[model samples]
Target: MGKYEKKLKEMVFRLGYFTRNWRQIVHLALATEHFGVNNRTYSPDFSLFGKRGPGKFLGIPERIRMMRARAFMGFIPLKDAVRLFPGYAARHGYLKGEENSGD
Candidate 1:
C-alpha cells in the first residue's frame, strides 16, 4: 500500500523468491554477494532491524519494505564502509568476468 511495501514486493520477486498468493508470507533471507574487500560480505541491510528496529513486531514484509527503502538512499558517506566503485562492483557480482570491470 505504501512506498516501502511496494519496494519490498519488487525485491522479493527480483531475488527469485516470489510467492503466488498475497496471504502467503515466505519469509527468508536473500543471498547477496557485496563487492568490496577480500572477505566476502553479503548484503547486511536486508534484515528486519539490524540497526533500525529491535523487538518490534512489524512483520517480515514490513521489515523488508523498510530495508528496501533504505537501500534506495545508496551507500552513505560512511568512512568505515566506503570503497571504490570498481572494487565494489567486483565483489558484488557486477564484474563481467573481469577484475574491477567498472574501471
Candidate 2:
C-alpha cells in the first residue's frame, strides 16, 4: 500500500479505537493531497469536501456513526457530520451553494 493508504488505514484503525467501529470503516476512494482544519492541514480519510446527506458517498454512514461516537468520547464538535458537510461535499464534487436537487 502507498503512504497515504497506510496512513489512512492507520487513521481508520485509530478512529475505530476512538469511534469503536473498526469493523466498518468507510474509506474514501481518493486520497487528499492535504486538508485543513483549524488552519492546520490534516489527512482525514473522509474529508468533508463533498458531503451533503447520509447517502452521498461511501463511508458516510460510518462517518455519521463516528461523529455520534465523538459525543460520548468528548466534546469534539468538529466530529459532527453536519459540520463536516462542506469539506465532504467539496471532495465529492457537491460544493456548497451548489447542491444537487435530484431525486
Candidate 3:
C-alpha cells in the first residue's frame, strides 16, 4: 500500500483501540457499581437508552461489527449525506424549498 494509505490505516487502528479501551473501562466501572461491591452506593442511569427489555445482550464484538457496518453504509460525513438527496430531487423535478409550488 501507499504511504498515505498505511498512515490512514494506522490512524484508524489507533482510534478504534482508544474507543474500545474507553468503553471497556466504562463498562468495568458500571459493573463494579452494579454489583454493589464498592463502598459507595451507585445507581445506573438507564433512562438514556430506555428500559432494558428482554433481548440478547450485545458484547464488544457485536457492537464493533455493528459500528463498522454502519460506517460502511455511508452514515458518516454529514457533507456527503446531502449528495444523496440531489439525485432524488432531479428525478422528481423538485427543488428543496419549493416543493409546495405548483411549478
Candidate 4:
C-alpha cells in the first residue's frame, strides 16, 4: 500500500477498536486468526486461514460454523494477530500493514 493508504488503514482500524464492544472484539479475534497457527502448532485439523472453521474438525457442519477468518484478520484491532502468529501470517501473505512486526 502507499504511505497514505497505510495511514488511512491504521486510522480505520483504530476506529473499529473503539466502537466494537467486548463480544464483538472477541468475535473479530476468533473469526479472523482464531488462535493463529505456526508450523509447530498446525495439523490437518487446524488451519488459521482456510474455508473450514475449527468446528469443522470436530464433526460440526461447515455451513454452520464458517467464519471470515482471513477477512476479519484485516480489521485494525486484530492486527497483532499477525505479529503474534507471524509464521503462518507471513507464509499466507498477511503482511500488508504489519510488515515488520515479527516475533
The prediction achieving the highest lDDT against the true structure is 4
Q: What lDDT score belongs to each candidate, Candidate 1 first?
A: 0.37, 0.43, 0.40, 0.45
Q: Candidate 1: give the clashing pairs.
A: 35-91, 35-92
Candidate 1 per-residue lDDT over residues 1-103, each given as its tens digit? 9968855654655344223321222222221223211222344334432323432444555655543333334632222111223345466554558655231
In candidate 4, which residue pairs clash? none
Give the clash count for model 2.
Answer: 14
Residue-level lDDT of model 2, residues 14-45, one tens digit each, is 45554542222322222122333222345545
Q: What is the lDDT of residue 8 in candidate 3?
A: 73
In candidate 1, stretches whose alpha carbon ends up further than 4 angstroms from where it belongs are 1-13, 16-57, 76-103
Steric clash pairs (candidate 3): none
The predicted structure with the larger lDDT, 2 or 4, is 4
Lowest summed lDDT window (length 10), candidate 2: 23-32
The candidate scoring highest on TM-score is 3
1 against 2, candidate with superior TM-score: 2
Q: In candidate 3, residue 73 scores what lDDT?
A: 59
Candidate 3 error regions (>4 Å): 1-58, 78-103
